[model samples]
Target: MEEETRLSRLKILKDIAELLNKGTDTRAVLSEVLKNLLNVTGLQTGWIFLVDQTGGYQLAAHENLPPALTLNQCAPMCSGECWCLDRYLDGRLDKATNIIECKRLEDAVDFHWGETYGLTHHATVPLKAAEENFGLLNIGSPNKTHFNKEELALLESVALQIGTAIKRINLTQREQDLALTAERNRLARDLHDSVNQLLFSLSLTARGGKERSEDPEVKETFSYIQDMAQEALNEMRALIWQLRPRGLENGLVSALKSYGEMLGLKMDIKVKGVINLPGSVEEAIWRIGQEALGNCKKHSSQEAVTMYFTAKEQEVIMDINDEGCGFFYDEEKELPSLGLRSMKDRTEALKGHFSLKSEPGKGTKIRISIPV
Candidate 1:
């Protein structure tokens, strides 16, 4: 029986490693790992917490959680106040720890008339690769209060695998981000050097014609041409800025305001809560906002737009609305609009939500919510 159990554990580990090696998205990968842990190991509950840059733990994945330990309650348990995280922070939780009774669970049991709870103790292993500590992998059971040495060893090995996979995913994402930034810079330079210069020359030529013309009608025509050329020049510059946004380094709000000014659109902007966000989340919002503004410029009869931005601890929300001429939104016809589709795709790729509301006579409103 001992040898059979060991072989079974090894097979479970192999299956989990295979799933992790598939290069799936982080959420999907972690969810699959948690599910496999529960299914293969017969653990009553399992969860993985990831340490964010702010030194806070976020529940990245979970499975088979009981009603008493709800998701919302997980925040406090992951805080530095908890025993596992406290040990992790102090460099004491490097190895799997067995029979660590949970104070929170004890309190819950005591509060509920001193009855025995379904869970009493859990094993925690530090999810680490090299010198980097990712977070913790925790497993618990109702009947099994303590883990044997062999069980602890297997859990530690699984934790190591998870940590290594997380590191690989992060490195891959960084590489892709660098590639994207480089490509955008190249496109921005080309547009500015070629299209931008040509538009400027057209504007100058129109102005010169307007100055030299004596006929009222001829001068008016030249003035109209000059205005159009100048407008096109402004739009081109805005497009280049969108491609490579230097102002984004300053902040998202400033960059967006600058873009709106370039488009000659009057914007009513309101921001609420703290605005600090992960770089990728901020970039997604910026790109989606740019698309929405571009659509407003192209379709709206009104020149004014309203933008509201909110940043909270767990998520960021943006709403862009315009009182412009709207179109009939149909899933069959209007869904194919490149701008709308692009915005939706970008939002969904980040595991965010995108919603659009518009009618033929009514104005357009776009709302995006992203969890960070």
Candidate 2:
């Protein structure tokens, strides 16, 4: 009987490994994993959560959840705070643990979502591959209040496999992204070298013609040609900037100023305090600044903008202001634009504050503050 039991567990693990190896999609693999786990272990229900660096968790997979948790398309599982996620984000959960009572289930009951189907507890296992922690795996049976030591150990082992699988998938995706980035860089370089250079040369030639022409009509034609060529040149440069940003190596301020100029706008930038920041933080700010300036150019109809940046020992604050046409904005109202929503989401993902102010004919202002 003992040999047969061990064999059964081995087969279960083998089946799981195959599933993990078969799929590249994280959520799909997780769903299948949970299903296979329930079948092999006689668990009534299970869920897997994958957490990102920003402390956001996604319910990647789940099986046999009760009506309460599944209501409203898994709204209960997706939103709000939970004990396991909080503990994991706080770095307090490092191994398999028996959460005697799930906070989510309790909340569901308290809020009267629906029945929990007697699932009051689960085994929470921290998924890790080597030293890198990924997320959590939870397994439970109906009326089960605790997990045995052996059960916890087995779950931990399986969690490790899951973690390793996730790492593999993530690395693969990163490799593909890098390849796409390289292709974009190549295209950007080609456009700058060939098309952009031709446009610049055309503008210079047109200016020379305007200076030499004696007839007013000829001079005006040459002037128009020069302006058009210059405008096209600027547009081409903007495309290149979108493809691959240059000068980020120098500093954020320099990059933003350059980008604004590429969009045919002048930048009035002021900086105070030493500007030292992490790579990730600087990258996020750069993206946000780009979008803000782009919106200013497109909608604000401004030729010049002002930027103020302050970097302290513990935090950084940036403000962008433009004196141009502005539309009404309400904080309570649903975000009316994708650009605004994206900026807010990205800022909040870093645990930062994002605020925007705009009124008809009063210009627009954006402010962001982030802690290190």
- Taking all chains together, each candidate's TM-score versus the true structure is 0.67, 0.83
Q: Against the hidden true structure, what lDDT does model 1 obtain?
A: 0.83
Query: Against the true structure, what is every candidate's RMSD?
Result: 7.3, 3.4
TM accuracy, model 1 = 0.67
Off by over 4 Å in 1: 71-80, 110-117, 246-372
Least well predicted 10-residue stretch by lDDT in candidate 2? 275-284
**Most lDDT-accurate candidate:** 2
Candidate 2 total steric clashes: 0
Tens digit of lDDT per residue, candidate 1, span 1-372? 989987998898999899889955877888888888878877778878887544566788877666556635654354435677777877778899874677656655656523334778889999988998899898998867889888899899989999999999989999998998999999999999999999999999999999999999999999999999988888788779888986998899888877876777898999999867888888888988888888888788888999999898887899999887887786555574888889999998777898888887789989999878
Error of 2 at 11 (Å): 2.4
